[model samples]
Target: MAKKRSGPSGKRGSYAKGVAKREEILTRALDVIAREGYRGASVKEIADAVGLSQAGLLHYFASKEELFTEVLRKRDEADLAFSGFEAVPASADVRDIREGYLSVIRHNAEVPGLVQLFAQLSVDAADPEHPAHRFFIDRGALLRSVFADALARRFAEGGVAPRVPPETLARIFQAVTDGLQLQWMLEPDLDMAATIDVLFELVFTHARAASDDPPDGRAVREGGAA
Candidate 1:
């Protein structure tokens, strides 16, 4: 005899259950990785955390690498949502983006395990053979482009001539943020958000000063007239 076909409701129920199970697995995997770091967390441990056998977990994610990729993707989605940039606003400017970064840093501080996981994985992924190497590379490029675009827009709006190219500024911003994360991981008491704010202040102050200086090295008056 053939298996009986389920109705639309049955199909919907099955789909919903599958999605829930997938999210549950992702959540549990994040928690385990947070505590154990990517290299330290075993597939068996993750599966056990979610009450599944390793083989069963494999049914959802074929490999640990694939699972790690999904976790990183989910983490980005969550960060975007928390940053209030799930959908960019028409009025969003560089200051808005900077605030978003600060907000994310604050959020990460509350989840030290996740921070530790990210720091450890990022360093290990520097090896070309690592599973997350490509992910980090792509992520770095995307973030740099985003920061560059935001800075460029701000420059255009404020007529603040940038002493450095937008792309260069973006790289600087990314470097500072990543460096601060590593430092914060080592010294948990460090205020990452405040440190980032100081970096922004210095960068923007320099940009503003450059914009105010004439080509001949003379400082312009505040009233737009030299």
Candidate 2:
């Protein structure tokens, strides 16, 4: 007798199933990297967890370098949804501002491995020929643009003269966040969220002081979803 054929329920291309498997493997891959470090983690290890052959893992990610970049990218996109991901939106209420920032701080506070991963990859990417060099640099530049645009819009809406140009502030914000993340990895107990809160408070306070007057500053609102 022949083995029974399975129904479409066992198929791989279904939207829900594919997404679930993708997330599952991606998450496992991230863990492997965190535990083993970049050079230590391998596709075989990831495949073992997923019950897939090494070749099967490669089907999902062509190479280790590709997997590494993609894992980081996925992590960042997810992290953005956490607390402390604030942008200086023109019409944002306190909730949006708080969530935006808290998202950043919260991620910094936890996931020391991710912080380490970013630092290692970034430094390694310094050589012009390094595969990830351009990707990392471009990502940094893009983040700076986000900061600048947000601050510019806020300044316009509030009728406030920004103490520093938006571009300058954006660069500084990313620099400080990256620096703090590096440090926090070494010292996991560091209150990253509080530090970031202080950073925001200082920036906002300076902006308010620069005006030499106070306006109806929006109250911060919490925006991170569970």
**TM-score per candidate, chains pooled:** 0.78, 0.70
Where model 2 places Cα greater than 4 Å from the true spot, the runs are 1-24, 31-42, 83-90, 93-95, 212-226
Clashes of each: 0, 18
lDDT of 2 by residue, 1-226 (tens): 1124433565553655556667778888777766776556667887887788888776766566666677788777666655345334455433246457666667555555566677877787887766567778778887766666666666766677865676776666777777887777778777877787777677676666656655357633332112
What is the C-alpha RMSD, rounded to one decimal, of candidate 2?
A: 8.3
> Any idea what lDDT model 1 has?
0.77
Highest-TM-score candidate: 1
lDDT per model, in order? 0.77, 0.67
Task: Report the error of model 2 at residue 226, Å.
Answer: 39
**Candidate 1 TM-score over all chains jointly:** 0.78
Instruction: Give the Å error, residue 181, model 1.
Output: 1.6
Q: Candidate 1's error at 213, in angstroms?
A: 3.7
Over 4 Å off, model 1: 1-20, 34-41, 214-226
